[model samples]
Structures are given as structure tokens and as C-alpha cells.
Target: MNFFYFAYGSNMLALRLQKRCPSAVFVESATAEGYAVNFSKLGRDASGKGALFEKQKSTALGVVFEIAKSDLKSLDKAEGVWFGYDRRTDFEVVTNSGETIETTTYLPPKMDIQLQPFGWYLALVVAGAIENGLPQDYINKLKSTPYQIDENQNRPSRLDALETLKSTGHSNWQDLFTSPRAS
Candidate 1:
């Protein structure tokens, strides 16, 4: 069975997904209605302590992945769905062709504002929004999204780590850097 996984965030990054599902096939870029991606925090990543907000929302813009049924389990585990996302079948519309296709969308489980997104994660999201054909104004808005660095302090409202990586040619350097450490 082939599964159409509607990707609306970091998964939008082709290089990132290729690293996970080596054989994953890329369907045309798509979008979900009544939804837009936003930068927010998830609960699990917060760990009841210092938490940074990740990019999340019900209406987030992402990409679509068509993968073999055999790879579904591995893909799910890679996405951290076991912790916060609930897998569901939904409709994906190809903005360029006006085609609607059946696909699996991940509905995030409710969590606190602590599940902050790291710089690399946010970069992928920004890339996804652009790929999904979101306007420059919207992209700029996403680029300027604000989040709390900690409980008492909010960081600058702009791309941080991801932007840095892009500048340093490290956006697709997963094998090159195991941890978030700078190259």
C-alpha cells in the first residue's frame, strides 16, 4: 500500500525527508485548507522546565510524501508522532493543479507551550511554507515568528538557528553534525 503523507512543516525539506526515507517518493507540493503553519511550542520537548516554542499549528503549510507501506512504521517513529501527533487520513490539494488527493495528516496531541522548536526545525518549516506557494508576505511573517526562549524571556522574532545553518551551508549536513553543535 502506498501512503500519501501530507507534510506541512520540516518534512517539506526534501533533503531532510530523503535522509529518513531513502526511497520516499515526493508527490507534488500541497496544502491543507483552513490551516496555516505557525511557530509554537510542543509540551513533550519542554519537559516541565525550560522550553522553546517549535513551529506548529492546525493550519500549517507542509509537503506531501508518497511512501511504501513498509516504510510507514519507520517514518512515523522518525517524526516523533508516538509522542504528540495522531495520524489520520485527510485531503491534500495541489495548489498548482487544483487536484485533491487522499493522504495521512498528523494531528498534534495537545501539549503545553514548552515544546519549543529548535533553529534547524524552524528552517525546514520556513522552507516548506515557501515550497507550498505561500506568499512572500506570509513567508516573511513566518520568518519573523516570535517564541519564548525560556519561561521568563522571549527571543527575537526571526529565524535563528536554521538561518545560521543556511548561511554556513549546513542545512542538509545531518551526517556532518550529529548534534546541534555548529560546524
Candidate 2:
């Protein structure tokens, strides 16, 4: 049994998502209308993470993956469903081929506009967007999002994510940390 999962944040990265749910398989690029992606979800690391918020006439572009039902618990754990995101199954996204698909996604319980994502975290998202061939304009918007540098240079997750991006052949991944817009 499998279910479609919509990934708009770091989970959009195939390698990243696969680590959590090994059965995850990329399906297609999708768009959720009337919503916008924002880095306003408070993360366990005290940095902002991506969340979708209702916005008039806006759309959030992302990737869809088919995940095994047996791995749902692992996916929930990775998403911090207990304290972070609320798993939503009511969302409907349109694929590039103009087909409407019912999918599940994660949404923050609350939003904090003042928060900003860590540079490395945002890099994961941008790299994922590029890997999935999302719209160029959407990728540019993601790059323009403000981010803060992690004070801990040796953060394990940060190192792992950046390394994953590099290993996935994202040559300019390092440049993503260079000039993040001020939060």
C-alpha cells in the first residue's frame, strides 16, 4: 500500500526524504493553489522551517512522492508530528500534467513570522527544488528567502545535509550560504 505525499520543504530533496522513509519515490512536481510557502515553522533546532499558509491568489510549488504506508510512522517522526507539523490529508495538488491529486502534507500548528530558516536548511530546500526541476522563478524566490547562519559550525545535521547536496552533484551548494538575504 502506498500514499502520495506532498513535500514543499527540505523533504523535497529525494535523498533527505529517503533517509526518513526509505520507500519514498519521486512522483512529480505539483502546485497547491491558494497557499504560499514560508519559513515560519519553529524547528527543533530553534531555526525556522518551511510551512504553507493560506494566501489569496498564491500558489506553492513542490514535489510529490509515493511512500509506503508501512513507513508512515517513520515519516511522522521525521516531521515531528507530535509537536511540530500537523499531518494533513485534505490537501489537493495539481501535477504538471494538469491532473488533480489528493495528497498528504505537513503544516505547522502555528506560524511565527519573525523566524528565519538556517542557511543550510534553506540550501536543502533550494537544492531539492532544482533537483526536481521546479519552476525557475520559484527556485529564485526560494533563494531570495532570508536565512541565518548556524552558530555551531560543526552541527551534525547541517554537515549531513550539505554533504548530501554535494554528493548529489550540486556543485554550487556552498554558494548558497554566501549571500543569504538578511532576515
Candidate 3:
């Protein structure tokens, strides 16, 4: 069996998602009405992570992917579903082609993310957003999103993971990972 998933954040990257679920495959760029992509999840690293929020006038743009149902468990663990998120399958993602897909997504139950995301984390998201050719405006919106430098200097850039996103034509990805935040 296979299932569709709406990947609005880092999972939007083909390389990253494929590593998590070897059977993952991109479906199309899609939109989630009434939601906005934001960094609000309290990550294990003690920094902010990506999640969704309700925004009446805005939609969270992302990609839809089909994955083997057998991979669901690993996906859950990788996304920290039980620790910081709850899995939900009731949402609909409308593809650019006007086709609606039935899929699952993970979101925290409460809006507790009060800090900025780490630059490295945000870079993965921005790169993935660009990889799938999400709307330019949306991509810029992601780039403009405020992110905090990873305070823990000892924490290394997720180089292995980042390689996946950088493969998507972002040779300058190195800068984006630690670019100066808007002052």
C-alpha cells in the first residue's frame, strides 16, 4: 500500500525525504488552504522547527509525495510525531493542476514555538522550496523568514542532510545556511 503526504517543510526536498523513506516520490506542488508555514516546534536541539498555523488569507505552499505505507513508522519517528507533533490525515492538498489529494501531515497540538529556527534548518526548507519550484513569492517568503543562528557552535551544520537540498541547484547553499539574519 501507498499513501500521499503533504510535505510543507524540510521533507519537501527529494533527497531528504528519500533517505527517510526510500520509497518516497514527489507528486506535485500543492497548497494547504488556511495555513501558513512557520517555525514553531520546539526541536530536540532546543531550537525552533517548522510547523503549520492557521492563516485565513494565506495558504502554506508545499509538495505532495507518495510513500510506501510500510515506511510510515520510520517517518513518524523521523518527524518526531510522538514527541513534538501529532499526525493528522484529515487534510486535503490541492495540486497546481487543481486536483485534490488525500494525505497525512504532522503538526504540533499547540503553538509553543516561540523562538526563531536555526539557520541551517531554515536553509534546508528554503532549498527544498526552491527544489520543487514552489511559487517564487512563496520561496521569497521563506527566505525572508527570520531565523536564529544555532547558538550551539559545537553543533555542526547538517552537512550530510544538507547535501540533498543543495543538489537542487543551490550552489550558494553554503551562504544561505548561515546568512546574516535581518536586523
TM-score versus the correct structure, for each prediction: 0.66, 0.93, 0.88
lDDT of 2 at 135: 74
Top candidate when judged by lDDT against the true structure: 2
Task: List the candidate 1 regions with Cα displacement exceeding 4 Å.
Answer: 41-44, 47-60, 92-94, 113-115, 131-134, 147-183
lDDT tens digits, residues 46-104, model 3?
77788887889988998999999999998999899888889988778899999987889
Q: After best superposition, candidate 2 residue 110: deviation in angstroms?
A: 0.5
Per-residue alpha-carbon lDDT of model 1 for 74-168, expressed as tens digits?
A: 77776566666667765555543677788876666554543455544555556655555666665666555543333322433224434444654
Question: Candidate 2 or 3, higher TM-score?
Answer: 2
- Model 2, residue 182: distance off in Å is 21
Ranking by lDDT: 2, 3, 1
Candidates 1 and 3: which is better by lDDT?
3
Clashing pairs in 2: none
Q: Runs in model 3 with CA error above 4 Å?
A: 151-157, 166-174, 177-183
Q: What local distance difference test score does each model get?
A: 0.55, 0.89, 0.81
Give the clash count for model 2.
Answer: 0
Candidate 2 lDDT, 98-181, residue by residue in tens: 999999999998999999999889999988988899877778789888899899879988888877888877655657545443
